[model samples]
Target: MRTIPLITVSLLALAVLAAAGCNRQPTPTTGGEAKAPPAAATEAPRLDEHSYAEPDKVKTKDIALELNVDFDKKELSGSATYTLDWLDPKWGKLVLDTRDISIDKVVGERADGNWRDLTYVLAPTPDKILGTKLTIAAPERNKRIRITYHTSPNASGLQWLTPEMTEGKKTPFMFSQSQQIHARSWVPLQDTTMVRFTYTAHVTSPKDVMVLMSADNDPKAVRDGDYSFTMPQAIPSYLLAIAAGDLVFKPTGPRSGVWAEPAMAPKAANEFSDTEKMMETAEKLYGPYRWGRYDILVLPPSFPYGGMENPRLTFATPTAITGDKSLVSLIAHELSHSWSGNLVTFARARDAWLNEGFTTYVEMRIVEDLYGKERADMEKIVARNELKKEFTDANRDLQPLAVKEGVLKDPDDNLTGTVYTKGAWFAEFLENRFGREAFDAFLRGYFDHFAFQSITTEQFADYAKANLLDKYPGKVTQAEFDAWLHEPGIPATAPQVTSARFDAVDAVRKAYLDAGTLPTAATTSKWTTYEYVHFIEGLPEVMKPEQLAQIDGVFHFTGTPNGEIAQRWYPLAVRSGYTQANPAIAEFLTRIGRRKLIMPTYSALVKTPQGLQMAEQVFAKAKPGYHPITSGSVAQVIADAKSGKTQ
Candidate 1:
């Protein structure tokens, strides 16, 4: 396990102190006289300690970006000019985060509005995760600073693809995924969630390609190799996203649409036909959608995460185009983030549960409202089972939802089933205890109060106590809240989730287990993807290869096009030594790059010597198509196996 360096900790402490001092309220003057304070004195709450930026000294209010996209060099070369709002000019310097970026020059505006070259220093590398700190000398009354820089070949946030990797095999593609601290690799800024700034950009791309961003986007207009954008809403740096490729768009509704490669745009539009309804449902539940239009861009199969909740436009995976709308729950999940994550963000990755868990709860509600209660209940039951399996693995490194204070070194480690599943369970518990109407009102009010702000777990608790618990004293107790939020593992009061459809599937699984016989196809002819997943997951862990063959012959799980079903079944086939499923497993591993499917299948393959060799061979061919985040995770699994460590 890795830890933060001592020097980084010291710098972070200084930044926290500076922020606290800057935020202190002004004192009353003597003889009943009062002095007006600077506008920056009433600073937004600084709750994030994961960043090295001292925003109290000098803060950025807006950003102006000018960049050129060179696919041949696989680089984004540009200059970022930031409008600064200073609090304490005597600090004399500004620090920003950078990784794998080449700086050409740093210049600042003087008090008399003249640009002057400024001396800057890139601090020594601290750790692979934290990157380096770029410090620039500042003039006494400087209001703007510009850094001319370009990204390196190994920038983690970027993924440059050849024509062969794209759906339309005629043009190349380039996309960015910059969440959870990867934004520093491509852009130098105060890369922290505590800071929010509006931005405008001028992007110059190839004549044949179209560019899109997380800002106001126009799909029908064609530009002469140059484009401009504006995002009026102040957003965190992680939501900064850009993509360029041979793309086309089709409107799904008045205020919603879908974008994809020209070859897949129509199919994607049809698959996501209900996106407008989802937005409307979410707004009715919470509040109005603050972002102007809600649209989705379906990337190629190599996208690592299920969905990234970029403010106006979401970056999605092609796996969600399952034709049957069974997988649109993922879209609902991302749309829920418009309220939970995009509007009100968690201060740091350590408090990710506040973003993910609340979104999960909201996702289920929206699904139930549009679809049905049975579908929603089935999803929750599956999630609960997955959480139990994670607990049974008993890995101390993978901590529970409410992890201990200061024990976390890397925020990515908190992205676990505990945070997502058990966190949703906590919300569900509250809803069940206090009644749906009351819980809904409370959530709407919570989002209203903290809109466009970064928050912490402790602050959330305080607000909940004052708003809900204090008003109705006998509904729930403080100890119960503490146990749910601070204690490890699921509390004893976890809400019970049940689904009749899953219960029927479980009975079929039990019948097969007890009698050692395969069921007829007629028994499951009317099942949906969720029912099939439940049936597959309920299979015995150590079934004989012959039994697996019998099951496959009847259900044809190996050739299923649905990524979720194949992901669950392939790992089971690998563990059972079913040689017949090898080709399908190889194709699945190589073609799809989602971490949820890739990690489990590869981890299962590396358990034996023969399986380890197969895993390596498949990975060699698939490595080029995978995003950096996916490849990094798969490499670690192989390394652990080589070191005789169980994954």
Candidate 2:
């Protein structure tokens, strides 16, 4: 998953959560504040708290899936046939995770290839976050089990968009965002990241639409109702994705391309044209691009996250196609995940830094290589500032890069800047301390050693100690290294990153703020999205109406096509009472469902009486088009404001 820059969605939530008084206890500090020793060289990992499946007992090895997409009912009826590996013969049951789903029956394959009905039970969940547990009585001799089920109309992982919600407005669209344990809502299996399984899928959709999955995709396949897919490589359930729509494909390179609605096919193809170059850059940094064909599927505006790194085909938000390729960092971030996340995975959500931090570090390296050091540096600075703003007293316990075993109440809680930005800073600290060449070699070795494996933070720590820390003893002490991991905030020794471009932009902003001086075309015309965001964010929290009008008139920020600029300028417009931008804000909010860009605008709007009315009115009309995740998040913001939790 790639988090957007400028401002994070969680930070906007934190702003509202502040008034509620976050009375939670903070995690214990390790290195800087308290000189504590690190854990023993290699400690055994605990079972995933977020998963009900006992992988040590019996794990899934592969799956054969058959499903029918019903647009009218807005449900997916499917049977997932699993090939199991009984790790311990004594274990007589196979447990899986599920949420808001209907199970017709489960059967086991006998020696003669005949299926025998198996006794199964659905256990109620104590914590809804983990979902329901499905346990099947499996005999030691049984190797194959099939589950016939249908997803709920309101499955959390799925977004069934009506025809009017799509770009073409002629055919309905359906897509899946299963990251962070949402897979259980659509497919019953071990939803934890601890286990991996290969899968083959047979899906039937509308004859007018096409289907795509994370598995191998035939770009030139016919747009028939039936589609078949095979994922030869083993992947966790979270990586299993599906989409069907009035889609068309255009190749950007021999191995790279995009799929989008006909109206967006050519534009999106042009926007992400550098995807092949990104793949080459990532391969040079790490190992080969293990996933066969690197393609991207650009979903409609209602897609939640910026991008999801689903093995072969990446699922992208329409917001990424800015016509200028200014937001391709999201692409780089997702592409690098082909190495850090898709190849080597995190065993649990608490150790998410292992996947995200490494990917952020590599993504920046790719950005620096493809764009320039200046662009990458500017991104780092913006991310750092956003992380600082996000870290509040209410969320102090959640600030550490390495979360405690039971700290995560919901998987979405892990989607904070701490895991993404703080983790990246830790990687950069290592790179700055040890030479880049040495660090690069260490990372290359790390990816190669752990390919196709799900590991815990302890495992990565052990590997790093043996390869990097122990190899260069005095360069980084064990205690200091522990600080970066166990500590609640950025370490004191973190490298101070600078960007000359941002400094120049700051000068222009300073003049404008101090003396109301208009920026000249020479400086303003060269500004990129990051530079514009920096300038807008640096403005005073409260400005005069005339000043707001002056900036909007000068820069045409009211309805800028650039999503990044709109996210920043809209909030400033709300805070400064720039009424001229209200219509544009409504259109932007209803059209773009990306949580990061829209949540902050809602957060700003909910603070005032008039703005709150506008927010509620707009959200009432827009909620139907949003994914469950996005709608739920924005609903909380509105509810919090109504209850005075946002005061």
Candidate 3:
């Protein structure tokens, strides 16, 4: 989900233009007079306006972190030493973003190898979105500042799970989801996507547990609970991730592997057996896989998102481990982010479409290459349906893909299919307008030029105009582009995707609805998860119990191992008042903490009085296992229902 808030700033707008490799030349006079450039044309120092950090004043270049993981206290105590570069010596102080964290001390390293304590303050002006601004004052002579701090129990970024919360029920697990602005809650740094820094970490954890970060991770090495990691490639703070648990690794390929609980390791490895091929396919489309090895850590069921594209290692949810390869498209999607997001990112939360949209488009391409055009089309069709639903139901105040004005109260609200589905359709629109071969070249060049930098939507629009649209003159008009990017809803020119597989599924759905034809195993024995989802989602919202039973008897969806299908089926059963499915619904809700699955099921249940009571009971039992990110939203769902508000 899109986490954090939107704080529009002039610095953030202009910085991304340069970061995206847009070269602005001084305009020459009409009469051949070479006049001096306008004063306003002078570039502003790149700062993440959305972030509480004043990076333009004092920037972070690299970080050296020494930390100990205290599982007992559910805290990470660490000293984060930042190698900084001062842009203005007179600024007097460096500001960073901090959430629920305790600052022990702040010290600066002098040129003569002397360390002195620096006066730092957690600002009295605390913000719900930006967190607290940590201001440190010290002499400009010291280019290095180290902050000793520890995460508080209230740190929303870190989820501490008990042994009983895990699959094996033998060891506890802790993982940090630091996207957008949550990084500050764990470690004091520039918690914006705008700042890029290389980092080396020395981590101490329990001897029985293994730790991994978004860096060069060694699966086979755990030296007496002390582990060291390095990420040479500079990355945005949002991608800085860490996880520790009793984990084991199983190699899927020479350069690809799976990390999960010992019991889940082999299953996850086999499930993502195509990881190496996905990397190879993505590289062929974009460029070489820059991060030496591409691996995946199958996180616990509670990992909110389907997958987080954390540089070398992608943190994935175990939900994707369906025995069939149908769900590996999520892996493909994350792999594509290696080029679109990990290598390059959005300058601010406002332009999140640049990261997600591009990745979604690339994911479709990779899926098409490996699977088939039909499979890719089916994915797009599902996404398009989701986008239409979101567009119709979205709060009108919220901006669309390319938000132009107004600050987002919470960036996580922007985590709609608009960014993923509409964004992909927009890319598809561009590809259709400017031939596939040309678009391919443009994408490869775009990534190569802006590698490891944060860019804005404006920069991307300008780059497209110069590289693609300019060549084709009036083929695509600027107004059309504006409508696609800056408008508040789906554009009329959006690509329309269709799938024959879904067509067949829809026909079957109609047959069931019209003539009460119960589909047997033979009818859908060859169907993929996508087709199953389409068929299940197409079922009538209010179905007779006997009809639901007949369908459930044939499909056994309640007992299905596929999370995707089960997520849809259980919600429908609840809305239809199929009490027999309640036990399975409760089990599903308690076991899976993915927001995508949890929210819909609970939301559907809360629509009726009885269902709302059921939802509350299940949530009470399940809340402890969910990450804050999921539980926070689920709590609101119940609260809204109690107040007679629509979801």
Of the candidates shown, which would achieve the greatest lDDT relative to the real structure?
Answer: 2
Candidate 3 per-residue lDDT, tens place, 480-595, comes to 98888777777888767778788889988898889888767787889999998888877777788788898887788887778888878888888787889888888999989998
Candidate 2 positional error at 419, Å: 1.2
TM-score of 3: 0.91
Between prediction 1 and prediction 3, the one with superior lDDT is 1
Write candidate 2's Cα lDDT for 167-284 as tens digits.
9999999999999889999999999999999999999988998999999999889988999999999999999999999999999999999999999999999999999999999898
Model 1 has an lDDT value of 0.82
Query: What lDDT is reached at residue 381 by model 2?
Result: 91
- Give the Cα error of residue 276 in candidate 3, in Å: 0.9
CA shift at 61, candidate 1, in angstroms?
Answer: 1.5
Off by over 4 Å in 2: 1-46, 124-126
**Every candidate's lDDT:** 0.82, 0.86, 0.82
Which wins on lDDT, candidate 1 or candidate 2? Answer: 2
TM-score, candidate number 2: 0.92
Q: After superposition, how far is residue 71 of candidate 3 from its true place, in Å?
A: 0.6
Give model 2 RMSD, 1 decimal: 11.3
